[model samples]
Target: MTTGRAAQARRAADALRQRIVAGEFANGRLPDEQALGRSLDTSRNVVREALNLLRDENLVTRRRGIGTLVTAHTYRHGLDRLAGLAEELTPYGTVSNEVREARVVPHAPPAITRRLDIPERSEAVYIERLRWLDGGPLSLDSTWLAPDIGHPLLHRDLAGRDLFALIEEVTGAALGSAEVTVHAVTAEPDTARVLDVAYGAALFAIDRLTRLPDGRPVDVESLRVRADRFALRAVLPRS
Candidate 1:
């Protein structure tokens, strides 16, 4: 038989799990135990017990030095469907966008020019942005668009708007398909600054090249996300 205090703690743990799954508390941040206790009208010990329950479930992990951290959860999307960033993060919370830099600049490196099929000296629209969940930076996105089709993109307000939708609107081109690669990389200085992590923190880097209906590559994007903040998951048909 469970005591009333134990039962209360169990209830609190369940509520906290629901809130996390519902995206009330975001990644890389932990909820305050005292505050949670106050909100739940329980004692600190009860809250601690509740947190212990969550820890056992593997939904959260206790670092040796750092406090508890919410482990990355898997997100599933349909194979044939494309969802905007905002839509994809809707389950987490209200996603916000900050346009750090948006300008037309001369191509700098062969990495971008080679993919976009543009000359080294050609100008391309360079867009840098930081995505936030619950007002905290979660990912840094950098993209280069070819000069021929990117000039019109320079004159738009992209805040709170999906880049893919904006591209379709400005160029009248539908996104047919995209090739993407995912890898883990140590965060660089700029990426660390935008993501609010240590200089050498582990990050998930996604490189993607998207094409229009006619197979013309329109954009090349590199996305850097904090390993603790964002996660990618896929489901496959069983053999």
Candidate 2:
């Protein structure tokens, strides 16, 4: 069935994305199409589709002579600077992601509207994902932004893609500053399952409302990170 084949292609893409995020291809190139097909348990046609999706998202690029080359999509985390969740973990190890949700919201919620400063009736794009480092669960992020910014994002494969960069690129509204809040919380059932941790486990929650340089709100993000899996450090110099 056509639907079945579509599902297979999506699965293939997800698996490949996970591997890419996991740093399995440290040489920075994917296996040949046939080899990928065999390893991913899909046909060459399916493998081609998966690769195409990754290319569309700018995760990898094809060359005339060489195979797909992984793009430079990483940023370093700074203690005294503002950055995205992915950037915050660069000092740790290799980072990857699993996208759980990506779609459009017809009616933006009040809390979302308040943060992004969009109209109540306007739609938005919602992206929920779980990030990984060296094959272990790391953090879960739920992000929402204006529809104009989210529309183009709805089509691409997101695994292994940097959410912060994609948001700024499509929206043309880079994050100049953010209102951040930190909290200690216990994991809920859904959160536990996604992060592969026990329910009621202690976690660190980072909430941020980001704004563009011109004072326009860009996005609101909630990141629930596993306590033992990540560390946050900073330095201070007295005047």
Candidate 3:
């Protein structure tokens, strides 16, 4: 059970969290505790409690002389939520895409054959793209889709476009939950060349296979993101 003071602190924290997410505060700086307490109709101690919670969440920093400052540097991806990459990243900064490889091929890689339920040497669309945030490389996404499923995308302009949105709009399929697996791997020669990282630099490999509402499999995505540029956060309740 939460005490009244704790509950009040949570409410204050929730309000500030929304404003920070909306980019209302300039340079991620929150006002002084006294000002925040007055605005929220709470006491200074309550405001401090709220700021402490946000600090624990990695959303702000509170120093004695410096007051409170927001320190949200990397994108915070919620593990319990499902959203398009654009929606996930747009809040941080401008997003752009560079389509590296977009074409229908006659062969499906052996690894994805079992996942896509296609035989070896089956037709598939292979798309390799680099995602940029504020003109800097952020992630490298390699996607393989069933040929008939993804060939239609070739006609559309893919540069600077959202992959999940394009697929949903074209296929009219309600994308369901994604089965994601995360791994920490060192960049290979090819990955290093594309991501502009050292040959053996650290990277995070995120593999996702999405399904439709009706249980139909779609594309398989292998995303290699700079480890320092991204993070995953989850809120777990006591069982």
Candidate 4:
């Protein structure tokens, strides 16, 4: 059941959310409800409802006489480069990993094995980690590595290090490139629980396969990212 007011509020909230994330409000404060309503071509009640929605998302705060305030910080992830999460995010805030699962499996799933170019029933190393930015959960990464490259990482420190850097160290070869795909998905029960999001909350899934300079596949990873905490950016020139 959807009402006109609710729909309008959501629309208003989306617009404001983008502006806040873009740093349009340089002072981190928003105009009064009436002014915002006029700019957004809506009524004061609708604008108030929109601001409340932002408040629920922890993106804004409202006070009696102070009006609405933007309070969320979104990290920009450039899609044009091949870099690790920590490597890209450290400039903004501290990044850490919680290794939830790290073990050598007798055989990985068929699809993963195919992507890694291993035999159908070949063994592989599996790593599942929860990535934290500052003090909050940012993403959940599940990576499957070919044995030759992964065995060396079993004893290495995975908590405070980036897998990309470690992989280069173990192989003595720099990573050449990656095949990456990004898409939106709803959080499943397990993912929602791990990321502390409500069931069916919107999330960004990044699937990537990394190759060495010689073009041999070494890693296949899928990262489930918190949509509100991250944004993907890239510069594309028309050909």
Q: Evaluated with TM-score, which candidate comes out highest?
A: 4
Model 3 whole-model lDDT (C-alpha atoms): 0.81
RMSD to truth, every model: 8.8, 16.8, 7.7, 3.2
lDDT of each: 0.76, 0.77, 0.81, 0.91
How are the candidates ranked when ordered by TM-score, highest leading?
4, 3, 1, 2
Evaluate residue 92 in candidate 2 and report its C-alpha lDDT on the 0 to 100 scale: 64
**Candidate 1 local distance difference test against the native:** 0.76
Tens digits of per-residue lDDT, candidate 1, 1-239, equal 64797898899998877676555666645667788889888888898888888776545776766776776552332333555556677776777789999988875478778788777777788989898888777788898998866777777766787788888897786788888888999988978887888888788788889888888788999988776556565556678
Name the regions of candidate 4 deviating beyond 4 angstroms: 1-11, 26-28, 38-46, 52-58, 61-66
Candidate 4 lDDT, 4-91, residue by residue in tens: 9999999999998888877689787899888899999999999999999988876788888787877657788898899998899999
lDDT per residue for candidate 3 within 106-163, as digits (tens), equals 7777888778877887888999989888777878999988776798888776776777
| Top candidate by lDDT | 4
Model 3: lDDT of residue 77: 69
Stretches > 4 Å off in candidate 1: 1-80
lDDT, residue 5, model 2: 68
- TM-score against truth, every candidate: 0.67, 0.64, 0.68, 0.86
Q: Name the runs in model 2 displaced over 4 angstroms.
A: 1-79, 237-239
